[model samples]
Target: MSLIAWAIGLALLLIFIFALLSPFEALGWWAGWGKRGLEPSPPSDEEMAEAQETVAPYYIVYLTAIGGVSAEDISKRERVFLARLKEALPDAMIVTDVFPFSVTNNPLNGERLLGWLWRRIHQSRMKRSLKGTLFGSLIFLRNLLQVAVSADPRYGPINNVGVANEIAKSLVRHGYPLGSGAPIVVMGWSGGGQIAVGVARYLNQGLNAPVYVVSIGGVLTDDPAVAYVRRLLHIQGSKDKFPSIGDILYPGRWRIVPHSAWNRALAAGKIITVDPGPMIHTGRGDYFDYRATLANGQTHVERIVELIADFIRPIQDVAQPA
Candidate 1:
């Protein structure tokens, strides 16, 4: 055989091996590989300013979706929602970008890819295995390269730990009474919701502080850390189908026989589900557009913020002194 033929055969063989190993890779992430970490840094000046305005009875740390890297990337609609949330909860500081650092520079961040593929599979109405296979392959390639470079896996529980540490340091720096039993709300949208669960678990274990998690259109998978949260509020739009993809991929949340972890959380009153009838997965039309509002009295964004404010007030009130 010619050299080119040998190279082609080798490439095909690798592809076949990758396909066979893909599912195992996806499962392995949850089982083990998604546990690497990076060192945490003190909250930056901007982060401090964002969270310092009012030392409210409750501290809210808002984690954005997968592509939301910085506050500057937040859209006008989102800004409006944030402003309304601030007005309604004047005593609280709604901190965004709680995790300011990206785990790896790899364009193929596995967690983000999982979210994207899950959404696509759902939107296309394809079978769940399609998402599993594609996500498995993507994660395999991503981790394979990371291992090749002797670098840590960028998207995993360890990233959650780093972000949680930063949040803890910020609360301490701002004098938020970490172990004083103050209410800590970790709110996340899309993939951030998964991170929120990890952060909640970290705070509960490391600081022994109770945490409340609010997931808005979030894609979630089973994580042992979820049990650490005192309460979980899941807000989903009736029209939004993307967030449910996690349930399909992982067989929890919406399953007929819910996963044991989720079932236990629900039974223990650690989970609450809310469906806002008029909302969609993202901005105005498609995902991430954020240009227009739904026809309801308020935009979907506004409504979500309003709902969050309403749900958190009682918790905050209970924490406040008479």
Candidate 2:
């Protein structure tokens, strides 16, 4: 065979092997590869200033969990948690918006040749044994490719920790520190909690403010991406199995173990753990409701509110002149 024909055959063989191991559908869903709508820009300067004045003492940037699509898509439990936040922090301003960060809705479409190959990979069980070996290799390759193409995963489930810092810079440009030098609270439930970790990392890198982070049920890990966000607080219920088990999220790995370790390391520093008591073993999506129960059931929201209030008061008190 000619050198050109041999090269062509070799290329085809490699592609066939890859398809057997990892299908495009699974790869796309996991990595969030390809195009997605851009995130909406931050509130305008005028709107931001108004929000600053209205949301004095604190400004909150809330990111939703995986596949959230928009803030309106948040679960009933989250709505409940936000309601509690509104009542508890009457003086603070809360800006809630949903961000689109994943590309799972559409099927994969590459070059026509690759597309047909992908279809075959999806259709064949004969490829199973080959798939078992290729699966791991393909996933690693795809993940690397996706990360190389975008700072955040193409899946758009978790907040892109890197992009989240840009949002914070925008906040600062719009005078977020305010005259009070008030603290900024970057809050998220599940996927959003991952963004909160990103935000803390962002702050630690350049902009340092008294930002108190709260992850309802975020995956915690020892990865360097989360190293800077040391000042974090995580709340998980006893019943929520999610805190212990990983999800089929964009990044694949969950943040629970990292959170547990973080809590242990910070045990001597500023970490504080708050348990909402037994409810169900759902996950962070259930935080708002579980917390709602704590708020209105027996202890009432005030008790928990007070705990948060106490956590934040010291900063405000320290800012005040004697």
Candidate 3:
């Protein structure tokens, strides 16, 4: 064989091997390999003492989207939304401890590598036009693989269990005992909304406490957990395409014949859906953007925060001072 032919054959073989092994590597990372350091540790004595002293009427657990936890990881809209939430509920303690389930921080993970490559390619000015088409394709493939692997019954349960336990531990570490009767609110964005539902269920079943869930432009599936939640508020942007992906990826969410658990929940008023028109999937178009005007002559951020405060105030025994 010619030297060029041998080189070509060897390159093809290596590519094939990588393609096969990449999924396994991604799956392994999802299964919690090399991620221990990122996990939240138990709160210290001082932290627990502080928590006990300033225990608020409600606890707000904020779960970020893919690759989002810190301010740097999130967009300006998310940061603003969080700030407004805190401002609106002065008595509630906001917990930003939940980590992203996917392999976002790990530089060595195969999924992260793929994401890095895609970002690099999409960012180049030469490929600006191609970026939208190619990047969307890459994202679709990534989301599909993630749903196929991580959304399954076997592997998916582990993530919820871990997150639930972390939440419980965090409560205990912060001096909130199990079954403390303190109301817990979970706010999840994008994919984190799925995790919030799972965590709510676990908290209800395992800890004997129900939690209020707020899904902001998040994709959701029907889970028995909805039965155990105190209330579920799903805020979807009219222009947001990300949340609709759940319908495509998980058809059961939209099925009418054999009503999915989510459908049933909606029917029973256990879940409430809010459509804030003209909002996009991310950034300034989300619920947080002060620039986005609402029909009521208030900014989108202002109106949404008002809605949230109204929803939460009635649930709490001690209301915030007007």
- State which candidate has the highest TM-score: 3
Q: How far is candidate 3 from the true structure (C-alpha RMSD, Å)?
A: 6.5
Candidate structures ordered by lDDT, highest first: 3, 1, 2
lDDT of 1 by residue, 220-265 (tens): 6666567788888998877788776767755555547555577779
TM-score of 1: 0.65
Kindly list the per-residue Cα lDDT of model 2 for residues 191-277, writing each as its tens digit.
456556545654544445556677666543332344455356666666665544323333324345444434344644655567665
- CA lDDT of every candidate: 0.61, 0.48, 0.64
Least accurate 10 contiguous residues by lDDT in model 2: 100-109
Clashes of 1: 1
Q: Identify the leading candidate in terms of lDDT.
A: 3
What are the models' TM-scores? Answer: 0.65, 0.54, 0.71
Q: Say what the RMSD of model 1 is.
A: 9.4
Number of colliding residue pairs in model 3: 0
lDDT of 3 by residue, 113-193 (tens): 365664554344225476555444443344334333335555555546556666766565544554566778888877777
